[model samples]
Target chain A: MAKTPIAFSLNGMERSMFVDPGQNLLDALRRGVGDLSPKYGCAQGTCGTCSVLVDGKLQLACITLAEAVAGSSVTTTAGLADGSELHPLQRSFMDNFAAQCGYCTPGMLMAAKALLDRNPSPQRQDVVEAISGNLCRCTGYEPIIDAILKAAAFMRTRGRP
Target chain B: MALHRGRGFACVNYPIGMNLGGDPSQALVHSTPDGKFMVTLSSIDLGQGMKSVTRQIAAETLGVPVSDVYVDTADSDTGPHCMGSFASRGTHRVGNAVIRAATEARTQMLQAAAEELEVDAADLETDGEGGIRVRGAPQRTISVADVAVAAQFKQGRTLSGRGIFLVPPSEVDPETGEMSPVTCFAHAAMAVEVEVDDETGMVRVIEINSAYEVGRALNPKLVEQQLVGGAWMGLSHALYETTEPYYPDRDHLPVDFNTYLMPGPGDVAPHNIAVLERPAEDAPFGGKGPGEMCANPVLPAVANAVFDAVGVRCDDLPITPEKILRGLRANGS
Candidate 1:
């Protein structure tokens, strides 16, 4: 198949890649642009492991076309850190032991970031609803929920990172 | 006609390690020239913290700080032999192997320190802070790093050790058909509360409380993770998950995470866990594996809860709504 060129702002860096026709954003990011944070959990848009923020909105990269977000800015878990400093969510995840196998961490963290970006002081129910689309088999969802809430509290007090 | 809440309890005693013929695990402990230790093993950690637990075991046996030891479970082909990580044997079997290997390495480290300190090997003790010293006189001490350098460059000695742990298979008498399968057992008791809707035949697990005797938790946090997540899995098995929903027909099998049903985050209940440690004599550091048995009690507890709520005996797995409704109709309630 002939490849189509697309350009986008990924994690605050300008990246351009030649992608096959109808390639999903996940493949383009992982293969073409080399951002491996967005994982491929379910390509059918069920598990949210491929979730990324496109133009500051939560979108499933596995279902989204790479061409659709040509000029838009995308963010993934790989971009969550600032050089050596970790995002508040990452610290909270570590402190709370939110991840076990960590296969679902990227998407789960993206979902939580989207939630915190919108509502900085979400209730426990909101936290549950935010990560409802993502599936984590190891932590029983409690520690992840606790981590998200803790990050929200920290972000609210110290300003979002 | 309405929602009824009921509570049910169940208990279990689960065996440790595989019952097959001679389940074995091996480890190789070696020291770097700078005194850091690396433990090599073929065991795999499938999110059960095998690497972390074994590292702690190695450090403990070597009388070194935990940070000085690193467990490298690089690959099965490159490392020592292991029976793999099923039957919750990774911690128990692999941990014992690590203890043995680290003990041997510790002996070598002490001998090297003794050579430098001009003291007997038996009189030299690890300070547990990266230093080796005379047992009674702490002032006469040598850093483990210096000892490693001397042992390698001065003495031309290699500081390494290998160990393997095996549980010999038990033989069954042909006539009586009895045998000892495992060395020790982990015990647990759980009580589950559920709400059963008589109209929709729906069951919702509300709360769970359990006590586990895990034979000395090597890592309490890891044990808690296992117990909490294991209970969720048990809840999933009791009500939500099924690869083949319609049995005997072999149709509409779930192919992906969407169709393959599991309890979502919203479906979770408050779970309270109490861990009891009795310290098994034969266990590594008197610790048993907490991987497999934490979910066993939930299956029967949920079944008993359903029966208590709606007076239906859901003996089959997944305790689906259709089965509960059928049982209710047959009861003429």
Candidate 2:
């Protein structure tokens, strides 16, 4: 199969690459764009470790084809921070000790970011529902939920997006 | 048409380190010209904060600030030997080795400082701030960096230490089949409450309360994470996870995470944890590792809860909905 020319905006930067037609968006981001934060957990979209935002919508990168979203905006955990300073969610997660083993952190952060983007002051149930797709083997889901709620309050005070 | 609630409890104990064939962990400690120390060990962190705990141990032993110590767990080939990070032995075994190495290195540093001050080594004490001072003489002090420079350049003494910890093999009585395998043991007790819907034969865990007696908590946060994560693994083993679809005959095995089921965020229940610190006599800093013990008691506790809920014993690994329904029909409940 011939490679197809695809272009997209990634982490606020426009990138173009020749990707295989059968290649998934995860491979395009990790191999083509040199973004390693989004991990390959199950690679079948069940673990949600490859979660990323395409056009401000949450989707699994493993199942989403690269050619399908030729011209779209993609956001990853690496983009969550502003240079050296960490984002509110990252700080809250660190302060609350939300990550253990850290394999599921990137996906959890992306899912939480999507939730807070839609509903700034979400209830506990709303937080649970939003992160239901992501699976974390550590922290027992308590601290992760607490971190998201705390980040929401922190973002509210900081007047952040 | 009724939902029955049941409660169950279990207590378990697990050994700390590997006992067979002599489990050994080695560490090398050396000081830089700038007074900063580095400890190189082959132990892998596995994201369990092994580096942080070992660094703290070395700093405490060397009478220096924690920030002054850096642990390099680079690789097994480059550093000293460790029996890998499993059996919850990383803290107990590697920490002892680090303490021993740091203590030896501290002795060398004090001796070098004594030579620089022209005082007896016995009268010199470390100030825990990279400084060595004479006893009862507050103003007479020499920086550790100055001592390191003199020890290497002037005295031709290397400011380094090597240590290895090995548990002696125990003699087993063949007739009695009794032997002390490990030095220390960690204990835990767990209680689980669950609701069973008779119509659908579905079980939902409402709450879990657990008490663990770790020999000591080197880092409290790390211990809590291990306990919570371990309990979740126990829950998975008791209810949700299974490798074989049909036991005794491998058919339609799960090849991916989709086919294999694990607990999601919604399945998590309220967990209350109590940590008890009973210092072990022989352990390094009285710490008996609590890594692998977290998942032990959860299995039996949840199994007993299912039996109590529907009055049916599930000896199988996963007490799935199909098993519970079959048990209910067999018991004619």
The candidate scoring highest on lDDT is 1
Compose the digit string of candidate 1's lDDT tens values, residues B209-308: 9999999899998899889988988989999888888887779888898788899999999999999999999899899978788788999999999999
RMSD (CA, angstroms), candidate 1:
1.4
How many pairs collide in each candidate, listed in order? 0, 0
Q: Point out the worst 10-residue segment of candidate 2 chain B by lDDT.
A: B282-291
Distance from true location, Cα of B154 in model 1, Å: 3.2
Error of 1 at B251 (Å): 2.0
> Where's the lowest-lDDT run of ten residues in candidate 1 chain A?
A152-161
Per-residue accuracy of model 2 over A22-60 as CA lDDT, tens digit each: 999999899999999899988888889899999999999
Q: What's the TM-score of each model vs. the native?
A: 0.97, 0.93
Model 2, span B1-333: residue lDDT tens: 889898989998888887877889999999988789999998998767788889988998998899899999959888999998988888899999998999899999988888999999999998888888999997999988899889988898978889899999987889998887887889999999999998888889999999999888888888887788788888988898999957878997888887788888788888899999998887778888687889888888988998898887888888888898899999987
Which one wins on DockQ?
A: 1
**What lDDT score goes with residue A72 in model 1?**
98
